[model samples]
Target chain A: MIVVKFFGIARIKFKEKELHLEASTIKELAEILAEHFSVKPKEFKQFVILVNEVNINKLKMFRTKLVDGDVVMFLSPASGG
Target chain B: MERLTEKTALIIGCGGLGGYVIEELARVGVGKLILVDGDVFSRSNMNRQLMAKEETLGKNKAEVYMKRLGEMSTCSVECHTHFLTEDDADLFERADVIIDCVDNVDTRKLIAKLAKAKDKCFVHGAIEGEEGQVMLVTPDSKVFDKYYKSVDDTIRHSTYSYAVATVGSVQANLAVKALTGKGGKFENKLVIIDLESVFVKTIEL
Candidate 1:
């Protein structure tokens, strides 16, 4: 299971702190999450996805493969000052 | 600390995070400060802004902080009583470090681009409710684009005093480190603070 977490506005929107899911890649995870949370798949684009505390963008992005026991976080940018 | 007396920091915005950043920079002896913010203090800002007080209501944020810091510190503080735009590009050239404490995403993107163009270290800070994020962007880093590319500026996020102060302090710390040649660790990394969960973590960007 991949341990998924949400932060900032994503947390507020999902109303869930964390969840455990099974997925092979970030793209698959996003699809599952979008369906489970009742949001559009495109909404995940607004989040910075991190796997094991490293941004997926620094890796292969949505195509990055997930592994068991990996920690994933979806974080939205905080624009307020 | 003595070395800080010769460094300059240019800060954009004088609201919640900006207020704390200015206070910290002033107290720590940053020799010069360039503050820009056209907005004035209002009743709504009293809850989070450090310089926003009853006496400062209706006063221009930049000007008010200039006067407040001038009286308390020996640092030379200059302010532009207007919002930053492309015309303010020259201001970035004059400072050793640039800070973004703006409330809007468009302005933050502009600052990031300007700082990158000028090869200046940019310290970005923002707070929403119980969460805040601080990132140090070196001239070559593309962290801003990666983090804010999909952010919706039309949406406003609620901010609190504690989150503002915490993030602002972290921003100041990064600025000081950049000025003092000790900020390599922060490059390409984003620090996220969650007051509700009481945890602070750094994610490699």
Candidate 2:
């Protein structure tokens, strides 16, 4: 099980701030959210995913494994000055 | 002037964030500064850009900050009228700290990488609408990649004046603390603010 949190645009679209779900990897987690929310999987790919306070990109991209009590946050890029 | 009088800083971008960051650092007497920006002051910039005065309209942003810093402090201000790049890593080599006032995440990554390589403190700040965030990245920390995660490459946002000032002030404060050995609280954390709801959250990474 993992706790998934959303920020910025993801937060606005999901309507819910966070959710708890069971998943083994970030790819599975994102796929689950895409199905539940009716959003395209490609859109999910664009999100910056962080697992347990560490960026998934720093670990293993979407294949990073998740365990119970892990916190995953989805964030969008900001480019304003 | 107590602790910052001899410190040098590199400010990337002379727009909204840079305007306030430069002013705050100068006021606190950061004795050396490198101002980089490849923009001109347009009428629209007057709203939140502290240095974008009507009289200075059409003037180069970096030059504007250079003149303003010169008038406000005895800091040796060097103006680079272009965007920062890997080639500009030389600029960071001599600075005590680097401030990320640029709008894009790619540039922020460059600065953060250089700061880490040079063992310099990287004070990061960004604003979008009424929301803003500040973070302190030390030599060994990977906070930039952790928090941003290439978000700038895919998302676009606009900023507001209050958020810029608020976040820029925090950036300056962190820079001061890091430079003066006062210690930084956001080294492995990120402080996020939403002025619309008056909400602030600190995330420990």
Candidate 3:
């Protein structure tokens, strides 16, 4: 099981701050949230996901196994000056 | 300056995003601050800019920002009152962390490259319209080339909104986290926020 923190729009969508899921990878984690949140490509829920603060892309998503203490955080991209 | 102890930050703009980032950093006891901006507060900046006001219009952002930040803390706050361009490498050299609050991409590129060269931590926050995004880059990452994309790219769009304050706050959080050396987080990744969709996910670049 991994603990994921929702940020920005992610927080607004789920109406919950985070999720504890028994998943093996970031991809699985994303799919779980996508299904739970029912996100659509049309809606454009474009956020950069990080695992332990490092990008999930750096690891194997959906396939990235987790240890009991591992942490995941979902975040929104900030476009500011 | 002693209050910050181990943390020192350089804010590149005293505008919208910069104002909020500075407010939070100073509030949390960032020891030394260098506020760099060549522009003055303007009427158009009143929308979402905390430091921008009708009476403050035309006033140098660096000056106004330093005055406000000083009141926020007794720590050292230095105002450059000049743009953080290629010429500001000296200022960048002195920062332990650099928080970007400028809207233009070219300037972003300059600071990004400088931070990389100096091996400093760079925290970036951007907003266009109702959309905003934040990302962290280190001496080893090329995280912002996407922002320099053509003028029409989605990355270049920014908006003014009080509802979107969280986005900038997150960027500030990322910066502080890096400064504290508390852990390895917000490194080499972009956090995108679209208020319209109400969902956030991390896209690996």
Candidate 4:
């Protein structure tokens, strides 16, 4: 199982901060969130995704493979400074 | 420690996050500060802006904060009543570190580029409702190039003061750590903060 964490508005949308799910890649994880949140898959493309503390964008992005005990995080954009 | 007592800091905004950043930096003993912001304190800013008070309404944010800091602490503070642009590159040379408290993403890119060119460390912070993040970008890191997209949009109009204060405090802490080379953690990574869940997660760049 992979631990998927949500922050900010993502948490509110999902009604929880984290969950455990079975997934083999970041793409699959995003699909799970997309379905739960009722948002289009394209919407997940703009979010900042990290797998095990490393940004997926720097790795293989959605194609980045996951393993047991892996941790995934979804962070929305923050604009106020 | 007095390590930060002699260092100079440039804070790019004086709004919600910048006000608290300035307060902490001064209280922590940063010797000099440069504040920049073009807007005036409005009724909308009172919700989270530390510099926005009943008497400060219609007053320039940068000037008000500078005066407030001057009276509260011994640190030397300067105010620029305008948004930053290429013309302000010279200010970057005098600063040992920069705290990016600007709300606009395009300005963030400009500050990052200027910091790289000037060889100064840039400490970035941003917030939206219950969410915020902080990152330290040195000349070699090039963090903004990886984290930021060209598209500039802010979803939330205003969030609670609690989140802004929390994020501002973190931003000030990072700036101090960069200046002193102590208590630093997010140099090449981003620290994502969620006040609702009380989670502080750091992601590698």
Candidate 5:
């Protein structure tokens, strides 16, 4: 099971702080989350995805594979000062 | 503490985050501060901006801060009553550290690029609602490009006073560390603060 966490606007929008789900890659996880939240898959693009505290962009981006016990975080960068 | 008396920090924006950052840096005895902001204080700013008050309404933010700091600290404060642009790139060359407290991402991107070009330490701080984040950007850091993209401006996020003060204090602390030669662990990391949930953590970039 992967523990998915949401921060900033993502948390408010998704209405869930965290969820436990099973997925092999970030893309699959996004699909699952979009379905669970009833939002478009494209909405996930706005978040900065991190797998186990490391940004997915440093790995394989959306193709980054996930394993059991991995912690995934979806964070929206804040723009206000 | 004497080291801070010899260091200079350039801060962009004089709003909520900028207001707190300036106050803290001054209180800590940072030698000089160069503030740039074109905006004036509105009634809406009185709630969150430290320098915003009924008397300061409609006055240029940078200028107002300069006057306020002058009355309180020995730190030399300068002001530019105009928005920062590529033409103002020379300011980065004069600062020992560059801080981003701007409200928009485009200006933040510009500060990152300028800091990289000048090889100066850059500290970023921002807040939206109860959520805020701070990051220290070194000359070679690529966290900005990887994490931030063009954001839509249509949706305005509410800003709270406590959130602004929280993030701004962290940013000022990092800048002080950079100036005083104290190593900061926030390089290539984003420190996220959720005031509502009372959660704080750093995510490696």
Candidate 6:
């Protein structure tokens, strides 16, 4: 099972907030988010995806694959300067 | 009397927050002025920009800043009206204080890096909805470079309201206090303001 966390405003939109799923790829994980939460992937694409508390954008961001029990975090459109 | 009186200030962007910075700086008697921006006034900017007016639409930001500040004081004013990135390291090295008024985080991060590399004091500000935060950092802190490791350079958002105006004022105010050294301020921390509830909180990094 893979764990997904949503933060800031995105958390407000989710029913269970964070989820645990059995997805293995970025595409599959996103699809699972849509299916489980009834959300559109397009609207939340810009939100940063974090894996294990590290930004996916920095390590192997965006297209980074997911593994079982991996932790995924969805950041809001927050401006941190 | 464009003589250097106190310290110099470099304002990175002349949008919503930049305009207020200029107005407040002019009012407080900053020693020198450096205004940098690349775009012009559009209809959308008219809502919250302190310097934006109906007649100034389509005018280059640099030109408008120079012309607007010109009316306020005889202090020194230099307007670039262009973009500043790591490539503009010389500009980064020139100022005593920097106030970031740009809209995007990528631009803010780039400026913050250049400022730290030059060992200059960097003041940051951002506004969204009725929420905004102001932070002050030097080469020593990891507020921007360390904390924001995930923000994509290409990602951008378009949000505006009186909240941006109020929150942006906090940024400008913090910048002024950093320049002139007035009021209680944040040097290594950020003050987040929720204008909707009129609540203020500090987030220390």
Interface RMSD of each: 1.5, 3.1, 5.7, 2.0, 1.9, 5.6
Q: Give the clashing residue pairs of candidate 6, or none.
A: A56-A61, B37-B81, B37-B82
Model 6 lDDT, full chain set: 0.70
Candidate 6 C-alpha lDDT tens digits along B25-142: 7666777788899989889877677667888889888679888778877468998867886778887777878888787767887888888888887777776555566777767777
- Each model's TM-score for chain A is 0.94, 0.89, 0.72, 0.84, 0.95, 0.78
Q: In every candidate, how many clashes are there?
A: 0, 1, 38, 0, 0, 3
Worst 10 residues of 3 chain A by lDDT: A40-49
Who wins the DockQ comparison? 1
Q: Give the alpha carbon lDDT tens digit for every residue of B157-184 in model 1.
A: 6777899999999999999999999999
lDDT of candidate 5 over A2-67, digit per residue (tens): 999888778767778889999999999999999998988889988888898888888999999999
Name the runs in model 5 displaced over 4 angstroms: A63-68, B150-154
lDDT: the better of candidates 3 and 5: 5
DockQ each: 0.72, 0.37, 0.21, 0.61, 0.65, 0.12
lDDT of 3 by residue, B73-123 (tens): 745888998787676787778998898888766677788888887888888
Q: Candidates ranked by lDDT, best first? A: 1, 5, 4, 2, 3, 6
Q: Please provide, for model 3 over A1-81, each residue's C-alpha lDDT reduced to its tens digit, 9 standing for 90 to 100.
A: 789876544565567676788777666667777787797532422555567766656776446666765788765543346
Name the 10 consecutive residues with the lowest summed lDDT in model 4 chain B.
B149-158
When just chain B is superposed on the true chain B, each candidate scores a TM-score of 0.97, 0.93, 0.89, 0.95, 0.96, 0.88
Compute the lDDT of residue B84 as modeled in candidate 3: 72
The fraction of correct interface contacts reproduced by each prediction comes to 0.79, 0.54, 0.43, 0.70, 0.73, 0.13
After superposing candidate 3, which stretches have Cα over 4 Å from the reference? A1-80, B1-3, B146-158
Residue A70, model 3, lDDT: 76
Candidate 1's C-alpha lDDT?
0.91
lDDT of 4 by residue, B63-94 (tens): 99888887887699888999999999999999
Model 1: CA > 4 A from native: A58-60, B152-154
lDDT of 4: 0.84
Docking model 3 quality class: incorrect
Strongest candidate by TM-score: 1
Could you estimate the TM-score for every candidate? 0.94, 0.79, 0.69, 0.90, 0.93, 0.70
